[model samples]
Target: MESIYDEIEIEDFTFDPVLQIFQYPCPCGDRFAIALDDLKDGEDIAVCPSCSLMVKVIFEPEDLEEYT
Candidate 1:
């Protein structure tokens, strides 16, 4: 079965007004979630901090999905 991550296309990082959060998939196969209130523009990448992995928070429209 396909995963949710493979069902939808993910676009570049954009501020989600409704959720007020920034969401993106990291290169480490993990999802990186950041609060919009805690982020600043021009910040596209961040360290996982927890796992110490380099994570990119931005992606093209074809990079996201809703896997099950």
Candidate 2:
């Protein structure tokens, strides 16, 4: 399992339509990415592609309707 540093508000992340992923900037110069399908399945954590950091996304289920 990965270590979750803290919870990040959903408003902090941005969506990419082409990639269909939600991303937030990481201190490592990489980004934390969580797929739409994963979020729909009740997965809240997103990890950076370059590092071992992860954060739990704070959002309600209904928050995903706009993306789905």
Candidate 3:
């Protein structure tokens, strides 16, 4: 299996307007979540809720316009 530090495309994630975060499936059956505020602040890492793993989110600044 690949390391949890691997990077994934933004398209692989789903946005939750309520939580204001982006989430992706994790190999550990958990979900990796990154807050929209954090992303807007230039944070690209999403950590898994059930394990010690994180993936670098692939996105651009313009990707956050909808949330603003």
Candidate 4:
């Protein structure tokens, strides 16, 4: 199985209201991103578009209220 590059709190991510996605900096310079809908659906993986690295996002379902 592939390994996650890191485990990051949702609080550490930056939310883009226009994109409706949470993002974090990846080592490869591209941001790791996951959509809000995906999060709402209990998905936790944030992937970097330019690389293979992925981070496991840490957040409770209630935490999504602020983003919504």
Name the better of 1 and 2 by TM-score. 2
Candidate order, TM-score descending: 4, 2, 3, 1
Model 2: lowest-lDDT 10 consecutive positions:
1-10
The C-alpha lDDT values of all candidates are 0.45, 0.91, 0.88, 0.96
Native-vs-model 1 lDDT? 0.45
Write the residue-wise lDDT of candidate 2 on 1-68 in tens digits. Answer: 67897799888899998888999999999999999889999999999989889999999988888886
- 1-68 in candidate 1: lDDT tens per residue? 21222222224444466776655555666656655434444444444434544445554433332210
| Reference-based TM-score, model 4 | 0.96
lDDT per residue for candidate 3 within 1-68, as digits (tens), equals 43557798888899998888899988999999999999999988899989989999998999889777
| Angstrom error at residue 38, model 1 | 0.7
Considering only N, C-alpha and C atoms within 3 Å, which residue pairs clash in candidate 1? 3-67, 4-66, 4-67, 4-68, 5-67, 8-64, 8-65, 8-66, 10-64
Candidate 2 residues lying further than 4 Å off, grouped into runs, are none
The residue pairs in collision within model 4 are none
Per residue, candidate 4 scores C-alpha lDDT tens digits across 1-68 of 86899999999999999989999999999999999999999899999999999999999999999988
Q: What are the per-model numbers of colliding residue pairs?
A: 9, 0, 0, 0
**Candidate 4: 10-residue stretch with minimal lDDT:** 1-10
Q: What lDDT score goes with residue 55 in model 2?
A: 93
Error of 1 at 49 (Å): 7.0
